[model samples]
Target chain A: MSTIARAPEPAKASLVNDPKVRGLVYQAVLVVVVVGLVWAAATNAVENLRAAKIASGFAFLNSTSGFDIGQTLIPYSATSTYGRAFLVGLLNTLLVAAIGVVLATLLGFVLGVARLSSNWIVARVATVYVEVVRNLPLLLQLLFWYIAVLRSLPEPRASVNPGLGVFLNNRGLFVPKPIVEGHAWIVFAAVVIGIVASIAYATAASRKQTRTGEQSPVLLVALGLVIGVPALLWIVLAVVAGNPIDFDMPIKGTFNLRGGLQIFPELVALTLGLVIYTAAFIAEIVRAGILAVSKGQTEAAHALGLRSGPTLRLVVIPQAMRVIIPPLTSQYLNLTKNSSLAVVIGYPDLVQVFMGTVLNQTGQAIECVAITMAVYLTVSIATASLMNAYNSRMALIER
Target chain B: MSKRIASLALAMGLGLVGAGLGATTASAQATLANVKQKGFLQCGANTGLAGFGVPDAQGNWSGFDVDYCRAIAAAIFGDPTKVRFTPLAAKDRFTALQSGEVDVLIRNTTVTMSRDTTLGLDFPAVNYYDGQGFMVRKKLGVASAKELNGASICTQQGTTTELNLADYFRGNNLKYEVVAFATSDETFKAYDTGRCDAFTTDASGLYSERLRASAPDDHIVLPEIISKEPLGPGVRQGDPQWADLVRWTHNALLIAEEFGVTKANVDQMVKSDNPEIKRLLGAEGSYGESIGLTKDWAVRMVKGVGNYGEIFERNIGEGSRLKIKRGLNALWNKGGIQFAAPIR
Candidate 1:
């Protein structure tokens, strides 16, 4: 213990036996192997492409995509470039993901709360739904929704008129689109003006309540301002400006419904499948978040003479969101990624249009696939960062 | 799921690497020699094309393209059973051939200029002369493709038919909606379910797919052939000797038909004194050996899978359920485009 040489500093633990040095060496080896693999793969790709005389570059993106996508959110044609095709595919994917997120969140919240309800039937039913739906594969559920439900609808010639100028058929759901013209700008201006007034009124009313202890009917006033202003402007435009809003009603021809908006069955099926599938998982997350809130909070609210609705709304949801945000973010990402199953049902999402048809037509597999991966990576990163921002804002504070 | 896609990407990367390795390995030696060394032929075929390369319930493949592979095996080993099949999708067929995963690809692929020059593959000969056509319900009364204005056509996505349909419609100034599915079976399903007014594909495919329709008699294949689709077998580009062997193997089948050498009558005709027949059957000279084959290779192929005419009738022609008449697929002397080069 007191040796002056100290065994020559224990031989410096023999670099190999030193924990830190060993760790560094292992990590260095791992990195080198990974880099070597990647380098070999890249070189192989380059060499093979050159040997095959298949050009390897993104120049093929400018080439004409001579394939037709079944459903496109933006304008697309066979003559359109692969660049435009990729953009259309991206927009379609975003459209579905955005809509699916909104619908899934709303439904998931309702189902989660219902699952915790005192009513036995409601809670049991909610539990059964969550267990059953969450257990099935998303692709299988998608196929079920697409084939068994949507595709089984009546054919166009014998379409079911759901009334109000809407036609439901195997091809699509055709609805009348309002073709705004002339004085519609005045109506839009009134809506903007009303929204501004309502916001000002709400802030003032809330400030007054906080300062002077006077309850104002702010919600009623705000709703009245927004809706009444828009309705009055629309009426005045119709009366004085000769009917500004004209609906282009769908005309059911012998074989099709034309002249109005046509929502392809592909979109309907994909949205329905995504919504139903994602909501089950989101529901579980939401329930876990709600349950994570301590029972003391509810009891404390009750002791303060607060009603159940106010106590839950004012106390529960805000606190539960702290636990919910991170997992909820992941669920949203999963939903977005799962939307790629649109390829199977032919909904023409990013993977379907860009990664599939474009890759096949151009035979530029490397570039097309790389572009697709980059896009998904971008989408995932963007979504995660946005959610992370919200998460940090909601994170708990300690003194 | 992303991991699965990543692994798939890795596999594709390795495929490119394999392709580069194959190019170097294949360029130095004939694929014929490689096949001989391997002791069997590896043929790339369709994943599942009706009457083309579909496998039976027992997993034994038997189709037009399947038979062609068997003929190749027969030519090499005089045993048709020495061939193995690799089912490939439309997207990966060329890669399979270019990577040396298969000795030949007879997957009913259309021969085009870009495919010939680009993809590092060679189209030796056209076996099936096809063209894009439309099949509509008989009740629609659409006799020709020209009449199908404002029609909704169902087609498989990422296929030549999709482009052909667009071109035909644009050329004819017709407004149409295309409902594309991922598979021909799905396209047919959509068409059968009345989701589309018509189904479009190659003429032969139309004939075969029509038989799968709920009411086969209710659908009528339109008379108009929109675009020429010369379907053929393909091999890797670097191997000239291998390409020659595949080309002659196909040619031998055609020439055997021209010489009236039936599979049943091949043994008898091999003894014939006709110079052309004698030369073709290996009784005259060593024509087959030049392509790296035995002297009786043509005899083995003829006896194993029969001639082109017999194979055609058995798989996709009048003798099959498809009952597709030999229009463009008939021999040149019989008013068709199936003309082969002289064996000598």
Candidate 2:
């Protein structure tokens, strides 16, 4: 056996020349620099605030907020604590953001599908809508919706009665508010039960279809159980004990409507503006996502004797979702942040009620601003993580 | 990686905290010296209140508050043109003064205990004795503010007017919705377009805003004055010299008006034999020197913007379209509460 000459053993690198040692040293320096900067900033702020004689700290949150908000989702008054006022504003912001996200997504999917239609008029209309809406600044659109569309409506005295105890005017759309009297919890329980039953039925149906190569109308069954059970229970409860729910209809007062759930024109204008603007961008995103799905997939589905609808729904959509989700997450976050613009129209969102009125009243600018920033950061991170979890589930599993 | 992220987040949080605190640096106590060094006086005025601090089509500011700024500039530099106006909203006025963006704030601010103590600001003198009031459309036939129950009221945000509206309505046990806007213009416009049944603000502001309405005669000012709003100029605290200079400048205006000294006749009155006028005009005592100004300080002020009466008349009184009468703002001897300190 020929013995191969072994190569000389390599010498160990000096500490300064070693990549791992150099990286460690650089990281240590970076950490020290960062800590020093934070310390300096904190001390500087403390000194300046003390010198200005401006009261600092979070104690002001307990003080009374002697200002009224336009819209309050919870029990709030001028005598409420600043902390409670902050909560009211936060709820209002979340309400608008949640409604805006759901509505914009539904409208965007429709518009996206229309943009790819074989018909010329349908495609052109969708394209024009996207271009015109996305090009204008959101602020201008908001102003237009508020000043031109809503403000042009007549006064409450001349309000348009759109039938069914509803009034529409510049002040707001007044709809009869349902007041639950008694045994309403029964109806709620029925809804929960119906939902659980439908989910279990859907799972069982899917398993049967996979095993026996048979399909079931799972969606129709689920919808029927959810809606039918709730309606049946509600009607039975009403018949048995007078009425379980009563609607408080609005009455015309001397100056305006007195009762009912009055949606402020500011809220309507803001929601309309946000949904329209954000939908345009989401429509483009959806169209791009659909186009990213390879054409060969659709051909293969058709070759397997699947119809056009099944080919698109089963073979195209699932794959397209993988591409759409990441960008869609960003749009959702942008919509949520843009809700701060409610201040301009007096919607009493977080910025308007808390950052504007509360900060001005307490004169604790640092604490108020820090709280607002932290709230937004927490909300954004929560939204992103939720989307990331869904994205990972939708991710392609490679063997 | 998680540790790195935690540090990054900490850094970002500290940076934001720093930014919020850094914007409100305690300005040096030498505001007057800084103004002189900069060669121009930065005066914070209203964004657009018709008779108080509105800018013209040519961007020339001319209002009661604007004239006060010009008077201060004239007192310091002997030139009324050496002043720059910073138009501020109701919410931004105190911040602007505290941050030293403006040497003084004459934005028709109300003097209140919290503002004086907590906001680190000082009100030199009450320049306009105004009161918060309500204005409603005449077509509504609402005779008094008491009849405005269940009404939607419009007001500017971050003003005492907002608080007073709440207090008044809550005290009377009435239900009313408040739609507060950021600017006075928006508040008035919302009221004009019938978004609100009534508009609540300082009576002076109500009268001024009426002029901008499509039909100025349709609205009527209610008889009730809800709250006392002693509108005045504001300056930062910790600068006693600057505060004194601003306070004395307002006192000089009142004295000039009391002595019947007008802008056009100031030069002729400078040589008068009256001891009070002599001292006020910088002829007898070195009052101006105590405030680090030239001897002709009051004379320059009067020459630039005239007395308090002239300013009120030109901007919002009989000489202007507002035609607001001198009700409570008249001098003490004239059956009003406007009293000035003795120049002697």
Candidate 3:
């Protein structure tokens, strides 16, 4: 009864005066302007292309490329369609990016940890490596690796043979390729079965440890299952079927080493350059991630009678991973994109083969550039989402 | 919501009007007028192909292709020096021309069906008649290209030579690996370092590149000529007037050379009585005006860069260090196939 009369409801505001209406109007205008710009740009391009008398469209993908790539992952020739050439280029790019990511991460982690080591020599060496590598431009490093280091190697006639059917020369590194003959599927099936069994065993062992407070040599057992199963079967097949696996050893030919998997110097130099350059940045990232873990956490683990190794692995690393994942994804993306410098060294990567050769051949500037851009966008997005998913999994779970 | 829709419609209307205006501006095709306004001809030349289009230590460009660009400038502006050279890579030559960055591409670009039609380019005339060939080290003992089976060949990318190398090897049922670089220098360097067994390019280019080798005498060009490469000056396809001007400039040079017009004697030849020479020297009909140039256009061109024979000799032929024989580039009446249309 004593409650004051509520203030009269504000008079209905005019549409122009209403904040919500103004925001909606502004947004609508912005959307209209954006759409108009895009429409205008597209139309202008079409009009210009038409006036220039340049043929437009994606039909040229079916045309013969009439060019040969230095390094091809798939079967390709001058007679191959431009579409096939594109796929070959894409696969080559993916191959380098994948290998670069894995090797760079491993080297980076080692260097990062070594930089913080108690041994002065190890720490100083790691610091010098990171500083020197990161300070140099990636393109310069690539050129140095290709021209100064790899190209200076001996010619094929005087190739450096470090035994074991491996040869190194200016042309390439030729290594014996393992040729699996007859019932290769059986070997593949064994690998799959071993991996499945090892995973199941790991789960069961962890459950048992929690229930009975017991421990098992989980890593040792997993490794044995994963590697031993296939190896045992391989030996058995070799005895029964006169060697299911044989190595095609490389032999000196007239111009180069023949009859082996030839890893061209372009690939070697590109990979080496990318790995060394990206590892420097990744080392700093890893160091920052490691240092971000609180000192109290380490002390607490030590007080609980855990050693430095276990404390770092179980308590500190798990927390540090939460800090490491996001930046690590960026470094991975940078390495992938920077691989385009392969064109300078004739690596036959996506930019080298497709954008450079294919674009010049077809003169489809718009289409080729659009496709290359779209490819990079897709790859970046895919890589970002994967790291984001991993980052979410490692995030703290608060009650 | 209705207001938002109305605003969008209004914005779209304005955008359409702007786009229409843009279309009208883009359709303007007076290249000569544009070049005149700029007061210089933008010519695309090779980045560095020695006798074809190489810059000297003083950064002054003087080569066969560079002189061709100079001749064009003389035809248009009556001043040979009223031109600029944009050195373009093999991969970027056509795009540079297509994007209007250069009025003409006098680079050693081969005239092919795809380039003429699909690339929206017109080849005025074959300034240099070339063919793909191979160069190998004498130590390799490769006497002929036929013996180059299983050889790794280095070549400049984005050229007819690369394609011809592949075709020749494939057609002959031979195996070869092609390592193509983005520049002629890289290709030659790779070959010199023994990264490849052979280097393949135009026969003219082979001779030009051999001079840069550490030991020029060590390498020898093979006798095999693989493909016909009619290297010419190219222009945008839609502008026929510009095409005619370029074509006529080349023809004038050839006609002058056929009538024995040299750079030193071009001034004296203008007073001659030969009907064809008088017509070519712009002393006859209004032929030069028809192509948007003054009556003395050919006179300026010949005086500026000399005729075809003079240009060839001074840049890449006997007078130069290249010492290349005229071969197929000699005039039609003088044993070679370099025939040109009459100025009349």
State chain A's TM-score for model 3. 0.94
Give TM-scores of chain A for all candidates.
0.89, 0.95, 0.94
lDDT of 3 at A182: 90
What tier of docking accuracy does candidate 2 attain?
medium
Q: What total of clashing residue pairs does each candidate reach?
A: 0, 0, 0
True contacts kept of each: 0.33, 0.41, 0.46
Off by over 4 Å in 1: A1-40, A196-201, A212-215, B1-30
What's the lDDT for residue A177 in model 3? 96
Query: Which regions of candidate 2 deviate over 4 angstroms?
Result: A1-12, B1-8, B17-25
Task: Give the lDDT ranking, best first.
Answer: 2, 3, 1
For all predictions in the order shown, the interface RMSD in Å is 4.2, 2.1, 6.0
Per-residue CA lDDT of model 3 for A49-68, tens digit only, reads: 78777777899899888888
Better of 1 and 2 by TM-score: 2
Best by DockQ: 2
* Candidate 1 DockQ vs. native: 0.37
Query: Estimated TM-score per prediction?
Result: 0.91, 0.97, 0.94
Which numbered prediction scores highest in lDDT against the true structure? Answer: 2
